[model samples]
Target chain A: MKRKEQKTFIAAFLLPPLLLYALFVLWPAVNAFRYSLTRWDGLGSATWVGLYNFRNILARSSEFMPALEHNVFLMVVPGIITLSLALFFAYVIHQRIRGARLFRIAFFFPNIISSVAVALLWVLIYSASDVGLLNNLLRLINPKHEMIAFAESSRLLWALVPMIVWSGTGFYMVLFLAAMENIPDSFYEAARLDGAGSFALFRKVTLPLMWDVLTTGIIFLVIGGLKIFDVIWVMENGRPTTTTHTMATLMYSKVFEEYNIGYGTAIAVLLFILVLLATMVSFRLLRRERLEY
Target chain B: MQRMLGGAGSGLKYAILVLYLLAVVFPMVWVLYTSAKSTQEIYQNPFGLPAAVTAPSAKTLETPIENFEKAWVGSHFSSYFVNSVKLVSISLVLILLLGAMAAYVLARFEFRGKGLVYYLFLSGLLIPMQLILIPLFFQFSDMGEALTRLLGPITERLGLGYLTVSLHDSHPGLILIYVAASLPFTVFVLTSFFRTLPGELREAAMIDGASEYRIFFSVMMPLGKPGLVTVAIFNFLGLWNEYLFGLVFLNSDHLKTLPLGLASISMQAQYKSDFGLLFAGLVIAMVPTLLVYMFLQERLTKGITVGALKG
Candidate 1:
């Protein structure tokens, strides 16, 4: 192809996606920041507030603080359990345990289901009705057991832990397992030859080699916890109270429901900043001398 | 004594593993079996085998069919299923083609502003969808008005009826977003993938008088199959299960996707105490992705592993 033709081809191939992305993704993202600085109902002309929305969100006893607390709770509580369980499962399955394939396949089944479906499945499990699985079990154990509404707004944050852990463990397991598999068998052999037990070998060898992927997994969990919306939306039936709202849900309700576009977009901007800071902070905190195997 | 203790330890390990396996599998099995029962039967016996399975009477056998019929037709799950299929497939095709085109150019060619373009796409990874969502909502409205203004005169002059082009509540509007939003990661992954491909093939094809376009279409894209498959699967799963975008963009019940449909049905079903319809709807929402996962478990896992390591 001629040089000009080559240039034409490049332009032709690149421009479509570039223009689309710029218009849809980049343009809107840039506009989000500008919109954050103004107070406007979505349909009306805007007036500049000059950080008033952010100030309100950052104020003492604001709704943002409790919602932010829920986000942290979601992140930390499930984050710890999911990571620990994933590591354990990855380690065990890596040891060539019996029915390893069955365990791996079955475990990952939940991860493939949509978050809405998973939330509904858990809602059924936690339902306070005769059809509720937990209530039924309780009744079987003791006839006098009163039904408990496990998914009510007040207890919803805590209830999400088991659901999150159940659905998330498999993905991280596969991630850590792949990293574990990449560790040359010779490292484990060397550790064993030096009188290290299985536990010691795992602690010293396997853990160190997979540390980078583990850090990546942690970042994923944090970001996922921060951006959690679908499950909460479904479980709350689209009316998440202040108690159950994460930043994402709050932003949605603020903009779409209450028409608080400025406040909502401000929350979105804060969320973007939070996600950015979380990713960077995680990298900084988890950064170690990269061990090249 | 030590050996005996080890045996007990391994026994306990197996026990734990088995317990977890049950925990994971049992709920899915429960949903499956419970869908076969009527709502009344479900309330009476949430855990037992449905009479459809245990007794297989002519009258009892109709329950599963009725549940599915209610979900599929009585509710709007059929339209939702079709809508999901149409939207996801169209979005996936466009994402793959456009992503591959841009990725191919960025990967193989050396040009000015290449770094700038690459970094532009890379910057998108940091911008969460939440940030863009509100603006996009308004942008769609603005764009709709702008297009209406642009097209109104032309249509009026051509003796056609007055025309207004609105992207709101349409599949094309959402497709544009899905494709555009998906391009960043698609290009990032495929750029590296294309970089790893042997340059000799391109040279050989060029020496044989093939054009750049021909080389790309014939030689590069074919060899890019594995990478394409990986990207395809990831994007397929993401777009298929996407909810937030659908929730914002689509409002009509008939236009709603599987996730949206499932969510709405779940709320209504719970309120109406129609557990059978909810269970059946859940199955409809779940079965396709479950089938895909079952078939492509190895590739799916490998894709995530590669993506994690790379990220």
Candidate 2:
């Protein structure tokens, strides 16, 4: 193909997507930015408020700060925990042990199930009364003093943490496992011949090599942690005085419950900005080229 | 003594692994078990197995199947199912085709505004669905009007008004929206794999007088199966659990997908507190996604490992 022909072909190839993307994605994002500046109930012409929407959310709304805290909590805590557990288990399975495939499948099963289902299941296990599975089990073992309502308490984090780890660790594990699996066999064999034991091999060869994959997993978890909506949405809808409210859930509440579209959009806009900043930082920190074997 | 301690530590690792797996798997197991039990049995002793090998007897099982039957027989899941499958399938195909083509252009060619073109795609990477969703809804709702103002006049003259297209609330609406929503990850993943392909092969094909379209279809696409299948399965699963978009875009009960349908039922049953029926609905909603994961775990793993970077 000549240069002009190649240019023509490229333009033809790109035009449809570019056009659709502009109409659907870029245009709408622009609309959302405009919406963030206005007070629009679904029924009316939106009233322009400029930055009042941002001001009120930053200052007044009861849901805003708690939700921001939960998102940041998710960012700092489960974000790290999930990645660590995923890497550890991926390393374990990468040891070429028997039933490694089973472990991989078992761990990944939770990510496949909807958060609504997982939250509901944990609601059963963490039920507040003797009727719940955990309480019932506790009764059998210890004749417990009191049944705990895990989802409804301030200490809901304890309950939420397990589910967060359970559901997420698997998906990330598969990435690390895939990366670890792709590690040439020669690397391990060389380490073994050098009299390095399993722990030494992991600390030196495995950890360093899987760094890019591990970093990728952390980046995913950080951004996912920030915008987590459904899991919290499903699990009591940020109940118990908004203790479990993530940034996304708080945004939902402001829009749906309080009928504050402007405030909600502001929250949404802030979340979009936060996600962008975090991803960029993670990329900069983690973008070293993967060392080829 | 040291060896025994080491053996014990190894044993502890297995125990921990088994326990974690059990913790996650048990809830799914318990829900299925209870679905076979009567409503009274659930409240009476959920931890225990059925007193006998019981079925969905009133004494043993509890399902809103009767309620669902009323909804479906009156409203019909057939339309909902057809609508859902049509929406998901059409959108999946569109994303795969356009995304792969665009990715090939980006990956293979060096051109003016390359960085801008690439960032335009990359910008979609960090965008939260909810962030862009509200505006996309406004745009799509007025999509027909927008088209008319832009190209609809020309198409009007061309008599392709016979092909008047607005995929909103209808099956095609769901398809169009999903295609747009899923485009970024698909483009990103396809580009990653596309970049890995040897450009020399395409050049050699060019020397043989093969058209770009022919090279794309006959060569690039065939060899890009891993990336293509990866995106297809992913777009399928992502669209499947999709609740917010389905809820907002498709307004009719008859056209609601299983996730949306279950959500509608559960929301109504909220005050009734019908835990048994709700669990059953949750179980029902989960089965299709679970089956996909079971069958296509490899594809899912591949897709997400690439999509993970978009994070």
For model 2, the stretches where C-alpha displacement exceeds 4 angstroms are A1-8, A42-48, A128-131, A143-147, A153-157, A185-197, A237-241, A257-259, A285-293, B1-6, B51-83, B144-171, B199-210, B309-311
Candidate 2 — number of clashing residue pairs? 6
lDDT of 1 by residue, A185-288 (tens): 88877787799987888799999888889899999999998899999999999999989999999999999988999999999999999999999999999978
Instruction: Go through the candidates in order and give each one's DockQ.
Output: 0.71, 0.46
Q: Cα deviation in Å at residue A54, candidate 1?
A: 0.6
- Steric clash pairs (candidate 2): B37-B60, B37-B61, B38-B60, B38-B61, B72-B76, B167-B173
Among these predictions, the greatest lDDT belongs to 1
- Per-residue lDDT of B73 in model 1: 97
Shift in Å, residue B133, candidate 2: 1.9
TM-score on alpha carbons, each prediction: 0.98, 0.86
lDDT of 2 at A277: 88
lDDT, candidate 2, equals 0.74
What is the per-candidate TM-score for chain B? Answer: 0.96, 0.81
